[model samples]
Target chain A: MAKVAAELKYSAEHEWISTDGSGPSVVGVSAVAAEALGDIVYVDLPEVGSTVTAGETCGEIESTKSVSDLYSPVTGEVTEINDGAVGDPALINSDPYGAGWLFKVTVESEGPLLSAQEYAEVNGGEL
Target chain B: MTENYTALYEEHKKLGASFTDFGGWQMPLKYSSELAEHHAVRKAAGLFDLSHMGEVWVTGLEAGALLDYALVGKLSAIADGKAKYSLICNADGGVIDDLIVYRFGDEKYLVVPNAGNAPTVAVALAERAVAFNAKVEDASAITSLIAVQGPKAEAILLKLTAEAQHALVTDLKYYAFNELTVAGHDVILARTGYTGEDGFELFVPNDGAASLWASVAEAGAEFGIVPCGLASRDSLRLEAGMPLYGNELSLERSPFDAGLGGVVALKSKEGDFVGRAALEAVKEAGSQRKLVGLKGLGRRAGRGHYPVLKDGAVVGEVTSGQPSPTLGYPVAMAYVDVEHAELGTALDIDLRGKAEPFEVVALPFYKRQK
Candidate 1:
């Protein structure tokens, strides 16, 4: 089972967002998503200045076995993208919550969100 | 419908493997990182549970004659311990399934088929054997297959065998099998693998599968052997430029279309085999679309069913494509018009409505040092 961070909020599509309500919210794929996708080889992220809509696909993730769409959990302007993850997608599998963060977004609004415990219950993850 | 489980299913669960429903069986897709597993097979060795593959025993005085009549290859010409790669085709020359036929004795042979097509192949063989003095029995349910593949495969096996049988491991020829006791279990060891590596596949009864797997794992510990699953296996075979049954060879395509016409054995065997006339006509007409290897000029890969284009016009379709883990680029196999099948020809694959540049290259993007 994947680990779920208690301080984060999750979406049904498996993206995680920081709940600190700071300047910019940190966002990434949850550990569950990374584990489900075996070996991620390539990641296509939205541009830094691009705007993303909640509950919409914002990028693509390609693994050895298959390809999957990366859905956005919040509607916002992309502030920055994780170049390290873009260069080596395996980092997402190794450290999904910290260095493997996909992007930082200046959130204007968020879609339906679940707490860490809720997410762990829904996705069979461990805290 | 209820799915089937292999004898090693519990072992896979213990290793925290991810499962996928393949060919009506719940099989392991990978244990952890498939990339790591792929590298392990290339650098050291990897253990694989292949019990899902179907095994059919064809025995009798006319076993040789039956296979020669049923399959495309000249099975009777092969030696006692040798194996032949052949295809069972329909009357229209379309391949039903590709098989590996192993001759155990003058009157005994084993036919191994892919998991999904096992029942169909057994039924087809039984139907074709009515006129011949032979019997077909499906033994898939009672058998288990395990493989150790890589450059270190032989070294790992030598650690498992006793000094008396060390010669058997070292002297085994490729595409050949010998009866040997491995890990205190009787197994039919064959130097054959789907990955483009010098490897061995062991056939044993279902009851001994778990212990044999554990013993092999323990013996291969020093050689860095990881338990591999179907994910790495797919990439490995693709990099080796091997044709998968459902992907490269299919009921809609003939052997000539896949560049495997040499296995048809039309001239050497005088006995008329199944699909002889249709295949003869196909041989005379020549294939319209020829299979060719494509190397991506860009980072994006062209996946299956993606349209291949020549100067904005659709010319063919990609059967299988992936990022080659060993070669560090994207490789694919596609069937294109004969004019565009020549090596070094430039083309574009319509990858998700975007054209990506590709060059036609030779099959088998990777090969072992030998």
Candidate 2:
């Protein structure tokens, strides 16, 4: 089972949001999503300054086996994108929480989020 | 329906392999990173469990004649211990399945078909052999196939066999097999692979599969033999420009359309064969669409069923494609209009909704040093 950070809040779509709730919150795919995706080769991230809606697809994540949609955990403006993850998508597989953070979002309004224990129960991850 | 499991399923599970449903079987998709497995096959070696492939035995004095009439290849001409790549076609010349027929002796032959098409191919072969003095036996359930493929394949096998049989293992010709004792188990070792590398495929009974696999893995540890799954197998074969049954070769298209006209023996064989007239007519009329290779000029890859276009007009469709792990570029095989199938022709593949620039190239995108 993949590790679910108890410190972060998760969306049903598998995105993890840093719960600082101040300024721009860091966002990345949960470890469960990264492990399920296998080796990610390409990441199409939402452009900076673009407004994204929670629970909607903002970009795509392509792996060798298949492609998946990257959904937004909370409605917000994309404050900054991770160019490093875009250049080397494997980082998302190796470090889903640290260097592999997808983007920073300026939270406008929050969407329904789950606690780490709830997410682990829902998605078969380990808290 | 419940999925079937190979004899080595427990072993794959023990190795932490991710599973996928393939052709009604619970097969391993990957153990770890697909890219790592792909590179292992290219740089060192990779072991694969191919027990899902169907193996049908044809025997009797008329076996050669039965196969000659049933398939597109002249099976009677192939020498003993040699394998010939052939295809079984419907009466209308549509490919039912591509096969590898190995002639073991004068009255014995084994036909290996893709996993999904195995049952159909077995039934068709049995039905086709009714008139001839031959019998078809579907032995897929009782058999297990293991393949060791890469540059160091021979060395790995050499470590398992006795010293006396070392020369036999090294001297085995491509597309040829011999009954050899490997790791104290009797297996038919064949020098053939789909990865476009020098490799050996061993056909052993199901009872001995797990033991054989363990022995090979242990012997190959020093040589860097990783357990490969279907994911790496797909990318590797795609880079080699090999066609997948459901993707490239299908009942909707004939062999001629796939640029495999050579496998269809019309003038050389002396007797009538299945789909002879239709394939002859197809040959005379020529195919409207030809299978060609595509090299992506951009970073994004074109996947299966994507539309191939020329100047905003649809010209073809991609059958199998991915970012090549060996070539480090996107490679694809597609059936395109004959005019757009020429080498060096610039084309575009619709990646989702966007058009990605591609160019028509030769069939294989990568080749080994040997």
Where model 1 places Cα greater than 4 Å from the true spot, the runs are: none
Question: Which one is best on DockQ?
Answer: 2
lDDT of 2: 0.93
lDDT of model 1 at position A96: 93
Tens digit per residue, CA lDDT, model 2, B1-370: 6688999999999999999999989999999999999999999999999999999999999999999999999998999999999999999999999989999988999999999889999999999999999999999999999999999899999999999999889999999999999999999999999998999999999999999999999999999999999999999999888888999998889899998999999989978999999999999999999999999999888888999999989999999888888887888899999999999999999988889999999988888886
In order, what DockQ does each candidate have?
Answer: 0.75, 0.77
Instruction: Give candidate 2's iRMS in Å, 1 decimal.
Output: 0.9
Going through the candidates in order, what is chain B's TM-score?
A: 0.99, 0.99
Q: After superposition, how far is residue B195 of candidate 1 from its true place, in Å?
A: 0.8
Local distance difference test values of all predictions, in order: 0.93, 0.93
lDDT of 2 at B113: 98
Q: Is the docking of candidate 1 incorrect, acceptable, medium or high quality?
A: medium
